[model samples]
Target chain A: MSLADLHFFKMTREPSLDALCAVVAERHAQGLATILYAGGTDWMVEQEMRAPLHDEPPLVVDIGRMGELRGISLAGDSLRIGAGTTYLELERSAVVQARAPMLVRMAKDVGAVQIQARGTLGGNLATASPAADGVAALAAYDATIVVKSARGERRIAMADLQTGYKKSTRAADEIIVAVELAPPPEGSPWYWRKVGARRAQAISKVALAGVAVVENGTATRFGVGMVSVAPVTARMATTRALVLGKALAEITAEEIDHAVDQDVTPIDDVRSTGEYRSHVARALTRDLLRQLGARV
Target chain B: MKISLTLNGAPRELDSAPLVRLLDALRGPLGLTGTKEGCGEGECGSCTVLLDGDPVNACLVPIGQCEGRAITTVEGLGEMAHLSPLQRCFIDEGGAQCGICTPGMLISAEALLRRVPDPDEPTIREALAGNLCRCTGYQRIVESVRRAAELLREGAAR
Candidate 1:
């Protein structure tokens, strides 16, 4: 088939955030299925795959030009990133580099220049891929997602957003407005890694993000976020609890292996076997811990 | 919908849906075939084009998002009788193999050269990382970009 064959039947390019939200809310009231699009990087492919299964096409709302969702700002100690801000914008922003270099690094790792030029931070989260690099990175930052609708807006913890695979706490009428990020504590050691088929333009097989602060060689703060280890991106709560307040050097692998086992619930899929993800997740977490140990 | 943008240094307008892929707009109605499509998905950089002086995957960009923006396809780079330095380097250094990925590679190389006139090997590699060329295994392509950069620096290439 010609490349031109892929086309959306119904679409409206919303010029503002308020209009976008109003359209979504109106559609929800009428029970018309809607899919919000920003950057269309992989969303179009997703739509094409689902074409054979559905009798009707979802209303495609183009939230690409929402001005309210387009910049990075510092709200006192926290960084507020507009949901419509493209990866290219993040990667190029000097403010982002200084305040949240990990986010800049994450932006660079997202599908190279082409995808980065179009893919938005909020769009990646909304897509809610089980092993998305953005989700894993945001989880590491302990980011809070701000979503809005005609009704109002609310903040959802990254850890609390995902309920399961391809599902989230976000309602149909709501769209992500911004992602609020609190910078990691000064001098804290953080690690982010995405293992994929290839370095560039490949989806993650096992994505991991971690942060830790060792004061005089004792763990003061510890957190880990991993993708492809469960039905959704997961915060390694059990693992963090096990490692917190412990000496970085004395943290044992056997104990961590058990803690990670409790934290993640991986399953076999086309990308990888669950067993492999389990092993990689453990090894990578420990590797991050080791890095933090040496830095201290 | 009416989308107005600068294409190949000329201001043009397109009448189409808001979500029609820029790749389709280029090939179907605009009649510019230099931008090829390897994977209609954004995975392959075969449809890479310049949007307001930045390289982007045309396959993923909706024409509506391009309103009043500047687009540079491979055809905009140069003509056959008067090849751009990057295109000349591609031919001289055997950068293109099987020809499908050449347009994208040239566009990416052009963007890099425009930004960093004296880019190193690693820089060149990173710039063209998204554009995959299976035939030449990328050594010649990298060399081609390096050659173009040198010519550009010397003012011998335009």
Candidate 2:
């Protein structure tokens, strides 16, 4: 019923990234179920902490000890964010806010200050929750999920990472190390919103993220993404095709609304009904695009 | 496993598994029951505590992750004999109702006043967003935090 059944708990603070990977791989090789211990264990306890054998607890490797996986930096064109960086850190980082303000706004909406102080972006990606605010923002930005194993390192696009609800392609021997975000072109207008049961600590019923760069009355770049409205956080291809490269005055509200209906496929769940999600997804898509249309 | 950390401004060491919730460690071995566990989950901020000066849910934090970090509980704020200004304000403003949410409310308010001594109503609400109160209806809690901020600012002036 509690963590008292835990048989093994190791704190990995090795300065070398390879050493941390080796430890995880070795643990996996021994046939023990392993979980990379980060600050976002609240959801893990509720969903994934069930032991294969009721008597024994899963192996939890405390990756928080590794100091190397803990910073925000800019490498060339993308922002290199360590997996251990908390949402609070993301909210306070000037560089991140400057580069991706929508991410900053979504980080603030993640949970209250308490949850934001501890939850990490890597955890959100690995959990593969369709309603996750951070994951939705990452999907909108087209971020890369950087993962490492004892063998080597690989990068997975955020859109291509999650395979299904509460599931991802992450291997047992691998760990999510960081997220790389290529900044949106300077001064691109972006909007993010989350519809929830209440103001704070409520899971999203439906969330939307939008970005557009309009110049000379024409949309040069535009992307609209939705969460909790599909199996995965996804871009509105139908919607983007209708508005991207089109003159602002030429796009009709009916086309925008229709695009939303075609692009997203939401199903009924505890938080919301499929009909409600579909209606809101259409309304939100139209509202955000209308706002972008005004800016042109 | 041996767990060691600074508890309520004192260096304390105890034997607890790394996976043990900090709430359990504080309420069990440490005998500091001031931190209440309303929802074993992190939703209710009844187990709020300051970890290295930042407010966090004690129920979600593993005892192992707190090693060497400064942990401040409700007791650290003040006690019966020497009540903290925030505690005094809570009493005067009638912020305590059923009493289950007071400790966490006080701890969260304490963290807010420490950061912004003259916070506005919206700012105070944002800071206390994590702490949920069903009894007080939150108006008095907000007033108590505002009064405590003034008290802290006046104390600094003297």
TM-score of chain A of each: 0.91, 0.90
Candidate 1 lDDT, B1-158, residue by residue in tens: 88899999999997887778888899988999999998878888999999988899998787877888899999999998999999999999999889999999999999899989999998998888899887999999999999988888888454
Alpha-carbon lDDT, every model? 0.84, 0.82
lDDT of 1 by residue, A1-296 (tens): 32333454566767678888888888899998787778888776664455253355677777777688888998788999999898889989987888777778777878988888888989888988877888888888889999999999899999899998979999878889999987766545778888888888888788888766678887777667798888888898888787775676787878778888898888888878889888988888778877877321
CAPRI tier for the interface of model 2: medium
Model 2: fraction of the reference interface contacts it also forms: 0.46
Number of clashing residue pairs in every model? 0, 0
* Pairs that clash in candidate 2: none
Clashing pairs in 1: none
lDDT of 2 by residue, A84-183 (tens): 8888889889998888888888888877888888888878877888887888887777788889999899998876788887788878677888999878
* C-alpha RMSD values across all candidates: 2.3, 2.2
Worst 10 residues of 1 chain A by lDDT: A1-10
